[model samples]
Target: MSRNLDLDLIRTFVAVADSGSMTVAANLLHMTQGAVSQQVKRLEDVLDCLLFVRKTRKLELSREGEAFLVKARQLLRLNDEIWADMTGQPLRGALRVGVPYDLVTRLAPAMKAFAEAHPHVDISLVCAASPELSDAVDSGHVDVSLLEYVASEAAGEVVGIEPLVWVNGRGSDAWRKRPLPLSMVDEHCAFRQVVLGALADKGIAWRTVFESGNIEATAATVRAGLAITAWLASTVPVGVEMLTPEATGLPALPAFAICLRFPATVQPAAQEFARYARESMANEPGTRRAQLANIA
Candidate 1:
């Protein structure tokens, strides 16, 4: 119950454990690597144990750290429950949520409906890339998140998976003859590697006409006929035509997973809200229409 063992240190500990590196953990926590390391060192000093061992290229958790992870997560969960109860209103604590821009279009109506149903529960949504979203959930900045991840031991339940397609501007038929200029998100994106690997296997020539971490920018470049881009078929922007192999001669890419994860501290209301959101998306129409009405 000491102030030194507060939730901030616990969160830093969790982020370091999950990311296995101080730098990546820093990016996830929105802090500097030195700050994160200093905090971790401070926590270790208070606990009187080293939580991690610095390996050649990785941060390996000590046995003590491994053992502490379970309890640490539980402590974080209990903290959230306490905050929810002591706020003096019925389930009136904030629910931090992490979601992608495309997924948000689909989640809006469901969240609105949930807000209407539970007026007391405050919700805070942090829009970010899939990597950041997953890291935020792992760090306990958010109780639950929707992320784009492949099947892994770390991944949780699958919310949805959509096939990817090459899309180009409506009037640009340049891709109809040969491999084309490509606009894409940065290497940190889960789908970026998938698309590049597919093109590599097919011996398709491509140049990086534009690269950005922002999905909106990539979509805009694709719309402007600047370059060809790959995106989830369901989330493809309007006014872009899907290029076909027969018509544009590009091989098809496989679908990617969109996963949902819950932090160890997720409450009953958050759980209920996640369920309602999923159910709402199940019945909604395609992403294009859902986005236009802002009711996804």
Candidate 2:
């Protein structure tokens, strides 16, 4: 006789896979880490297949686990739809969300999911730099904001930690230039400050080659092999290659926290949207850092 998979266990497993850490999954589910571990173990026992390879700081999916993840997501989506049909009230309202320009692509999936789930809700997405997003959250310009903070100074729930990397045009050694050519979004960009400070500390002379608040322009400069710039590991565009500290003799930059911030007055719609963002960050494979390894 075949045993049926427990929905609760599956839910826990998805959370763990999405967040890449048991502790984070536990926090998201409001369960103890031990409880989350037991749930995963129980699920593995039921399937007779190991799901996750536990590591020092994160969980990596085993071959079987990777195969299961797709089906698991389908199951959860079906379950949510059924439950919503039975019990979910009509969620209708306008919600303003602030996000960093760099993260718009990363957050698109969650935003799309939320829009589809609630057809009547109007979502106004505002894209800006992290500091502006934070200010928007504080001043009630947005119901929720996703902001990047220096890892040590971050306060909100951390959805992800991204390594700051130096990137230049693919196959280009522009970083070797004396007084390194630099491109930046703006003076207020957190990455800019970090990069500048790291350069200063290393006594590495550098000159600004380009400065623009437009991500596209900055990217263009980098892609044209005109300069090197600092970017998060995951957000590096396709045309650029990451320059390793060992190769470039540049100081390693610190990680940054990707966090969700909420205003004091959060509507139900906003809250629900926030939940979707959190879940998306947890579940999206690209956001998962299986190991705290530095990006080379």
Candidate 3:
């Protein structure tokens, strides 16, 4: 006889995996932490495999857990699709969304979930710099936009704050250059503005060695040890090390606000998309802490 997997248990597991904390998953699911733990244990028992490697302060997925996560997400998505098909009005519309280039990777899971839940909604994604995204939202060129701005200048629902930090290739001597070689995006980039202003304020002589609208190219430049760049602590690409201001003698950068801007008349599809994005960002690993730390 084969045992059926409980949808509730699977949901609890996914929540825990996504949030990386039992307490957070419990709050999100409106269940006690003990209940969440029990559900996880029950799921593990059914699979006869340990899902998470319990650490002192964090929970990491074992190989088994990582493999299970992919299947679990698929199952949950299909379940949601079936339920939505059976018991609700189907959503059908076009939503044009603008997102900053750096945040696209961070928001991928949320976008995937939204796509799975609303198959009929046509989503057009526009990836650009923050200023361009904001302009798109203001000009009605896009239905919604996820943008980054200086905290004091932001005007939307603040989702999170990302700490700005200098980044360079790991094990590279790029920081020791007399006139620092800098890599940056285009002039309209908020990060570029902040980085340049910080360097100028500190009287640090720097020269732009690479400039591109492409984040990958800029990160590649940094990774090649040709230049150093600044990015959100969380968004720093792989193979790069975040530099400490004190040790590197670089000016400290203030946090940047991550926010959502939408048109006044939001369609149902757009509203649902926004809601999902908000919830995903809230539960996103590291986002909650940043949000809490930057509350002002």
Candidate 4:
């Protein structure tokens, strides 16, 4: 006979892994620390293995636990998707969301699914660079904002990570120039400073060949073999080819994070959207973990 695994236990385990602290997980789950511990212990007992390494204050998943996490997230995503489809809680309100251009496509499916589920709710998407998105969040202009940052500096609930890579038009050797031609969307583009800093550290000479607030213009320039550009690997334009470190001899770029931010007082719709965002990104390639995206 097969015994069913409890979703509650799997959820608790994932929260602990995402948080790296039972205390933080407890807060996110709105449970007492001891209660969270009991849930974790119960799950481990059922599985017959230690799920966490408790040798230090900093919590880590055991090897078996790591393998279990991927499946757990998939389970939770399916559950949540089904729950939303069934109109759980039936939320109805207006929600404004700030999204960086890079994540606009990735975020679309969740938004569509949510809108279909809650026809009464209104969602307005504000497309902007990450900096502007943060300002929107701080000013309460948007109920939720998705921002990108150098992974080390990312704040709030980080849902996804992808490499920052150099790209050139197909068959273009634009990156080989003595003073490389770079295409940038704007000064405020999330990749700006880190990309420059990476090149500087390698002593690579570079000059801007194109700069625009419109990404289409920047992509057009790069696609025409006019310049090389840096992008999150997943978001690189179709006509460009990723310039590998081995091929370009350029310094390796740091990975960037897709993070969710909300005002201190989060709207209910914002919380729901955050959950869908986290689930959607978890299903995407290169995201580190499945998360709850709790507004902390």
- What is the C-alpha lDDT profile of model 4 across 1-296, one tens digit per residue? 99889988887887777557888777666789999999999999999998899756768889988778778766765776677668757778899989987678778888988888778899999998998887677556788888998998775667987688888899987889879899998888888988899889999889999888788898999999999998877676577787778866988888889988765345667777888888877675433222111100
Off by over 4 Å in 1: 1-89, 151-154, 174-179, 286-296
Model 3, TM vs. native? 0.66
Q: What TM-score do all the candidates reach, one by one?
A: 0.63, 0.68, 0.66, 0.66
Give me the overall lDDT of model 2: 0.80
Q: Where's the lowest-lDDT run of ten residues in candidate 2? A: 284-293
Overall local distance difference test of candidate 4? 0.80
**Pairwise TM-score winner, candidates 2 and 3:** 2
- The order by descending TM-score is 2, 3, 4, 1
Which regions of candidate 4 fall more than 4 Å away from where they truly are? 1-89, 285-296
The best-first sequence of candidates by lDDT reads 2, 4, 3, 1
Predicted structure with the largest TM-score when compared to the true one: 2
Please, what are the lDDT tens digits per residue for candidate 2 over residues 1-296? 77677888988887777557787778667789999999999999988999999888778889999889778756655665566557768988889988887788778988999999899999999988888877676556788788898998774457777788888999777888888999998777868778888999999999999888788899999999999998877777778888888877889999898987665344567667877888876664543353235473
60: Cα error in model 1, Å = 17
